[model samples]
Target: MRRREGGARTGRGVGVLRVVVVGLMVTLVGRLWFLQVVSGDRYVRAAAGVSVRTVALAPLRGQILDAAGRPLVANRTVPVVSVDGVALAHQADGGRAVLGRLAAALRQPYGRLAGKIRMCGPGVARPCWPGSPYEPIPVADAVPVQVALQITERQADFPGVTTELRPIRVYPYGRAAGHTLGYLQAGVGRDGLEAVYDRDLAGRPGRRVVAVDNAGNVTRVVGQDPATAGNSLVTSLDARIQVIAERALATALARTGGTSGAAVVLESATGRVAALAGYPGYDPSVWTGGVTAGQYAGLQLLSRAVQGQWAPGSTWKVASVAAAANAGYRLDARYGCPSGYTVGDRLFRNFGSADLGTMTMRGALVKSCDTVFYRIADELWRRGSDVPRRTATGFGFGARTGIDLPGEAVGAVPAASARPGDAANFAIGQGGVLVTPLQLARAYAALANGGTLYAPRVGERVVRPDGTTVRSIVPPVTGRLPASAATLAFIRGALSDVPRSGTASAAFKGFPFGRIAVAGKTGTAESAGHRDTSWFASFAPDPAYTVVVVLSEGGRGAQGAAPAARQIWEGIDGLRETR
Candidate 1:
């Protein structure tokens, strides 16, 4: 009976084991059906997500053209060599052997190439590619076509190396207008018009969704969007005038032994900057690949035209004379022309300490008599009015001229609490007064244009790729001079006399004034360690151009800065005759 009972239990156990085994098979079949039919598309999509990649296509940077539609800043296509970090990672020993072969072919250091391929790994120094690990890193740019061909033909050796045509920024004029047009680095603008209008110059970048393998190799292009080219920037710069200005400035600096200088020419009526030149100019192309520490350091001493500020010297006398006239000091009224004037404990002397007896205000301006202007400033200071400061501000001094280029400086003017000594100094454009070449140019332009002070402009217009005007830059009037027609006329006549028979007479001794009708002011400001800062602010009536020049540590305005201005005028004359 015990044996029979045991047999029944064993049979029941066998039956239960068979049922459990069958249930397991059925469950496996159900899961297989659900995976293969119900969720197959979802799994496939997940797999694709692991392989697909989106790449940002860089747009073609716009061309910066002069007013004549000639390109100052343009683009060139060059061959670029890139490395796939993902593919390199998949190799045995993390692509060390492959990278070694590449370094040998390219003649680059193995460690540098490795560091560029790695994505900020521990113990790796910078200049590492600041990009995704799955993306191809640019190892070399602007490489020779032969070098690119070598890598392209030897795919097996260079597993994931890519050769592509990349756009590089080019400056046709080179260092001619370097400071005005500025430079770019890694497809971004640095300074000048480049930085100010970067949004308009740098177009919208495109995108591409591509199917890539685990090795980061593009299997196929799934989707793409074409990049739009940037709009061409039409600048107010006249390339020919710019070249002439640069050559003239360079020649003057060489002749005077001056360390630095600046020259600017503006359209008197429109306030359009025709030529802006800075001494010790740099090549914008140097910023293309990358600038070295030494190369960048050299550029610091340059770019002084719109950026450098100094006392306007006698050039500020133009503003002072106008202020005096507006404040009811008669243009024809006579004042004593002494060699020096005493204000408190200080005695301010003229350029050569010459006394010309008593003379009218116009005579004072022509001779640039410091003592005559000192009396007017003293009278105004005693009355305690802001006419001097107001007059200077109205003519665009003591503030930025709102030029299109970057790094402009707003010159300083004395406050209402200024003392008689300060006022006397300010009258001669000395004391705490400061002015940039650009600011002085604008002020002189306002006088030339009959009281309209237009904010200076560099960019003229923007053009689309299809040759349509995006927008035009109309020269906006910032402020109008408070001086009336008679006051402006009197000042204009006095300025005309300056180049003809006044302080700047020696510089313009042989200049043909019949056709041009040149008018100007010469200034010499005292410096602590150097000789003086020379200045020349001039304008023409016929063709209507305002030119301002400054020489740091230069001896005399008539000798140093005036000659440069004369050369520029000669260039303008040549341009006109040719036209």
Candidate 2:
């Protein structure tokens, strides 16, 4: 009986054990099923996140070429040394030994190199890295081939250090047209053509899918999309002409003791800028790797060609001449060449207060007789004629030239409610009248091209890397001047005599007028507290090109600016030796 009772208790214990084991097995199987079917993709993605990384591949920037296909701003490949921040941080001594080794190989100070690798943040000064801490930091640019080879050859000593061939901007002309060509700061456009055409110049960036281990070491390149280089920019700037203009401007600035100046050469027919030069220039190469704020502020970064606004002076007389003709003043009519003209209790004196005998309207222009223009302006104001303002606007003043470059200044013009004195000043390009060198150039270009005013363009076309044309850039004709063919021809004939027997005659005393007939005007404007602003606006009468020069604090148009214009014309006509 006892044995039977013991056997029954053992059977019950075994049965209860079996039931508990079976329930445990069922829970384990259900959990495994849920994990495999419901959450499998989530875990897989998490796994991928740990091992895969995507890196951006920067595309090569395009080249800037001249009209003759010569490189103005170009690129060259150089070895750049870089250090991976994450890998360096994982070092036993926190990258000190590795950086020291790298510094020795690079012949750079260890402290300077370390400062460059440090991620920029609060309390950190620059030369500090401004990019992501996970990526490699470029510590050295344009490193020597030998130094780059040494570091790469000994990877164990310089862990995480790498040498890569990267393209950097090289100015073949060296500061020639620096302001117009613009520059790149840390691979981003800052001004001029670089900023305006940044999108087209900067092609699409590619991607690289890389695999890394737990220690963030790149194991393999999973996939890559090759970067597409930017399209090349073809500009209308003639390098030879640009050099000539620049040299001529420098000579003028030095000879006249002027502080600043600008010169523009434009193709009258197409309105293409051949040469645009500004004095007190700087080297664009200073912005290769990067530029400091202090360094940038100290540099003469302003492009006086498009950004400078000055009194048009007597160069404004041509527009006035057109206005007078439109107001029923006959071109052949005689106007007095008095010493001064009185208006509203104030006497507007001619330049040097000279009194000459009466002459025809054409002869007054030839002598640049200020009293004559002042009288005409007063008469127009008395009649309440809008011809002055209309002619000024039609000639492309008081508005931007719509150039492709950035930071263009829209000059000022007198309002409709101007007084007699104001009208006189406007006629002489003073008081409230202002015009940019570019605006004045465009105005003269319109006069040269027979009434068609263009918006002017520097870039001629965009081309692909394979030399295929992308698109031609043709600037539209903004408006038409109100001057008729007969009026234009008459004015042209008067201007033709300016360099030969007028105010600019002395400057062109020995110039070859027969070879290159230059039609122009000379102006010496008064400044309240500064020396007179000198101006000379001229164009070849055959209507091929127009050249304009202006000098601040320069004594007179004939003495300061006209000589430079002569030099440029000589160079343009390939008669530099003759002059």
Best by TM-score: 2
Per-residue lDDT of 525 in model 2: 76
lDDT of 1: 0.85
lDDT score for residue 432 of model 2: 78
- The deviation in Å at residue 298 for candidate 2 is 1.9
Top candidate, metric lDDT = 2
List candidate 1 stretches off by more than 4 Å.
Answer: 1-42, 45-49, 91-128, 131-135, 186-189, 213-218, 292-294, 417-420
Clashes of each: 0, 0
Q: List, residue by residue over 216-250, the lDDT tens digit for candidate 2.
A: 77768889998999988999998988999999999
Per-residue CA lDDT of candidate 1, range 195-255, in tens?
Answer: 8878888899888887766545677888889888899899989999999999988888889
